[model samples]
Target: MKRSKPRLAVFKFASCDGCQLTLLDCEDELLAVAGQVDIAYFPEASRAMAPGPYDLALVEGSITTPHDAERILQVRRRARVLVTIGACATAGGIQALRNFADVAEYARAVYPRPEYLETLAWSTPVSSHVPVDLELRGCPIDKGQLLEVISAYLAGRRPNLRRTSVCTECKARGTTCLLVAGGVPCLGPVTQAGCGALCPSYDRGCYGCFGPAESPNPPALAGRLAELGRGPDEVERLFRTFNAWAEAFRGGGRPA
Candidate 1:
């Protein structure tokens, strides 16, 4: 038997707390959403963690520790619907650069008491360890989109997230094509829409903060970047930024 208002929980593992902050930042909408559901276990907002068989779980962060790997399974069991929000939860985030290197060696170099640390070799997405119902991609995530997702949840419908590229967003905003006009080696063509085509509009290349667009052809974009005087190494570095461990971005902008 379900309650009149569904209970929602927010969980975190290895993250910068950006996405959760985005939820809190939805100031006005948060109040509205609060009326629709019970925010039962959001540690960032409240300390009271009601024992859950949560109706909806909004998870932020990657699984970077052994405990988190186990915890995600617990979360899955408790959550009827699990949505991974942000790059960390969906594509492993910026810290996933460690995936390409020796984590032990890096830990030893960075920490004076490296032996005290207990962590996984790779900072991995939540879905790698447990089944996820939906993914909201971003470093921090957009408040409007977050509200849309929550609204969809309350209404018992699929959240209509756009799968278009940042290039498409640029067109919608009437922002000039920096790739064509400024010859910038933008990742807009292959990157997912969101961030409002932020970087490109500000005279910088899109860094793919939202990861790959639907069926992204990264190699094709790499070729274009190469033509724009970017070397193979440079293009590889570009793909390794925010969503480094994402499957589409993992091959260093190779064909996905």
Candidate 2:
């Protein structure tokens, strides 16, 4: 008898859909992945939907509405392993800036009739709504690392996701430190390793798209920024970018 292929499902909530696109962007490896697993559901890739008690579910996006709150519970029930992909699902993404501001005012600014829109006051990460098996952090996750995660799940092994800072990648590539050499404000000291230091290689500081590194010393980094003549507000603004809702980036006080 032949063994059944593992069923895979991909889900989305409130997001830009960039992370889901990363899987599709994996043009070379996607066909190979399809052969290894049953692509039972992936709305971004196909309209053909499959009901699930899925072996794995890759969720991309944050929860930003009452309907999504209820819907995610159902997803959790149907999925054996729920892995949140991208900053939106893992750290609440840029939309989470609403959490610090007045949602009512925001709605009025964006829409002519705010009453017609149904939304929560704040955007929150997937873990806030359901128990997550894993979280893959990034603005748009690295395709190579994403493939490794899928491969690891299929083999029943832990995905070797790095918890280091982007500074490590910068050093490995022999890229000059933007902060030290060019006097650019960089989150590379605290941002997670991914993107292969793309911004720094192009002579720009890292923008913390991968979220905070493990136990990042953001305060020390803030002090360094001050030495570089960045004001307190500028330092706060830097931390409040892609992963503003992440605990490490948010710090002890309220998010800026």
Candidate 3:
């Protein structure tokens, strides 16, 4: 008897749809990927749809509404293996900054009838509501990493994801330490490695796009940034970017 192809579904919530685009961006390898799995339901790419329960589900974005909060539970039940992709799905994305302030007030300023909007008090990741099999971090996840994750799950093995800080990637790429040499306030010391130290190579600081690295020392990094002339508020803002709501960054990146 031949083994059947695994059914894969992609879901979205409150996001810019950039993570989904990363899947489409895997143009060259996509056909081969499709050959391995049944692309069951991906509204971003195909008009066709399939009813779950799916073997694998890739969720993108955060829960920012009552509907989304409820929908994620449904998604969880249907997926045998659920992987959250991008900062929005893993750490609530940049929109999570609203968690600090009044979302209703911001909604009122932006929308004509804020009362018409059925939104939650804060944006939250999928893991906040349901159990996730894995999480892929990044503002928009790296395509290579994404492929690796899928392949690993299908092979019943752990995804080979790095847990090291961005500083390690900089060193490997032969990129100079921006903070040490240029007195630049960088989050690389605490930020996860991905994007292959892209910003640091261009003489820019890591903006913490991939969220917190393993056991990150955000406070120590903040202290160093302060020594480099960055004010406490500036240091706080750096930690409150794409992965602001991540536990490692949630305390405002300051010394506790």
Candidate 4:
């Protein structure tokens, strides 16, 4: 008897759907991937949905509501391996900035009737609610790396992912450091690799879209920025980007 293909499911919660889109954006590779694994459920791609005991589940988004917190538990129950994709699933994303501010004030700022909206005071990563097998980080994850993750899971091997900084990629590409060349504030030294140093290659500073590296010395980088004439407010804003809630970037001095 032929062995059955592994069932795969893609889930969404409180995200912009950009990460899920990355999977679809794979184009040529996506067709080959579809042939390898059973696309059990992907509502973003099709209206059809399948029931689980799924072999793998790719979850994207933060737990921002009481209902979302409950739903993640159900997904965890059905999934053998749960992988969180994107900054929203891994570090709580930009929406987590609400954790530092008053949610009530934010609601009033956006909505005419704040009382009608039901949302948690803070947006939090998926790991806060359920055990995650892996985390793929980015504002929108890179499709090539995403394919490697899927391939590894299907082959029952550990995914070969790097925890290094984007600066490595910059050096490999022979791109001049923006900070050294033009004194631009860059998160390249501390932001995780994956974006292939795209921004810096085009002469722009990294905006921390891939989040903090495995063990970033953010304070040291902040001091360097200060030397470049950046002030306290700029330093704080630098840390408060895509992965603001990540521990490495958060003010308390721990890995994010």
Candidate 5:
């Protein structure tokens, strides 16, 4: 008997939906992938629905409300393989910036009726509530990497993702060492490789959009930033951008 096609679902909580768009942006590859699996419940792509238990689920957002915290558990129960895509789903994205501040005060300033808002004090990753099989990091994950992950899962193999720092990308692209050559306060030495060293090629520093690399030495990078005239506060702000809550990047530049 022929094996049944796997069911794939895409979920969202609190995000800009850039990651999901990355999936759609895989125009040619997506058509081929679609033939291999059943695109069961991707609201961004189609109105057609398929109920769980799903073979694979791609979640793309942070848990910013109590409802989402509870909802993620339900999604976990339904998915055989759960993968979190993007910084929001893996490290809470830029929204995690609120984790360090007074959320209630910020709410009051933004909303006309803060009391009516039903948000949590902190925005956290999907993994905070459920067990995730994999995490693809980026503000919006790279389309090629996204394809590799999907195909890898279907093939029962690990995705060929690099865990090196963005500095490696610079070296691969023959881009100049912005920090050493220009004295730029770059996070490339600590930030994960994925964006292909896009910023540094244009003479700007890496902003840690893909979060901290595997075993990243953020403290050492912070010291280098200090040498480039960056103070503790400036260094802290740099690490707390797209992947603020990632442990490797956390508390690195705080005063002693």
Candidate 6:
């Protein structure tokens, strides 16, 4: 007897949906992915709302409300394997910047009826609500890495992803060191290797869209940035951009 195709579901919470678009932007590769698994519940792709017990679930976005927190529990129960995609799902994205300030005050100032509003104080990652089997980091995750993860899942193996810093990618692409040569405040030394050192190639400093790499020395990098005439506040602002809520980057963003 042949095994049935595994059902795959993509869930969203509070996000800009850029990561979801990356999957759709796969274009030709998406056709191959379609043949491998049954896209059961991807609202971004199709309107088909297939029922639960999905083999794999790709979750995008952060938990920003009580409803989203509860929904993730249900998603966890139904999905055999849950992989969080993008910064929102893994590190709460830019929305998690609210975790630093007063959310209630912001709401009151923005909305006329703050009393009617119902939202969580903090925008938290999915892992904070449930166990995440794997996490893909980025503002909008790299498509190649996303495909590798799916292929690995189908083959019943671990994804072969590099945990090295973006500096490694820069070296591979023969891109000049923006920080050392130009004295630009770059996050290449600390950011994860996935974006292929895109910013550096354009003579711009890395913004750490892929979050922190393995054993990243962000404090050391912060010191270097300080030496480059970047004040503590400026360095903090840089670190607190896309992956602000990420654990390793969080401490790095703080004033020493």
Task: Identify the leading candidate in terms of TM-score.
Answer: 3
Candidate 6 — which pairs collide?
Answer: none
Measure candidate 5: CA RMSD: 1.4
The whole-model C-alpha lDDT of candidate 3 against the native structure comes to 0.91
Residue 117, candidate 1: Cα error in Å is 1.0
Instruction: Indicate the worst ten consecutive residues by lDDT in candidate 3.
Output: 247-256
How well does each candidate superpose onto the true structure, as a TM-score? 0.97, 0.96, 0.97, 0.97, 0.96, 0.97
lDDT of 2 by residue, 1-256 (tens): 9789999999999999999999999999999999999999999889879999999999999999999999999999999999999999999999999887999999999999999999999899999999999999898999998999999998899999888999999999999999998889999998899789989999999989899898688888888888889888888898888899888888621232
Alpha-carbon runs more than 4 Å astray in model 1: 1-3
Q: What is the C-alpha local distance difference test score of candidate 4?
A: 0.90
- Model 5 TM-score is 0.96
Please write out the lDDT profile of model 4 over residues 64-158, one tens digit for every residue. Answer: 99999999999999999999999999989989899889999999999999999999998999999989999999999989889999999988999
Task: Give the C-alpha lDDT of model 2.
Answer: 0.92
Alpha-carbon shift of residue 134 in model 2 (angstroms):
0.9
RMSD to the native, candidate 2? Answer: 1.6
Candidate 1 lDDT tens digits, 146-191 = 8889899988898888999998989998999998998887888888
RMSD of each: 1.5, 1.6, 1.0, 1.6, 1.4, 1.3
Score residue 178 of candidate 6 by CA lDDT.
90
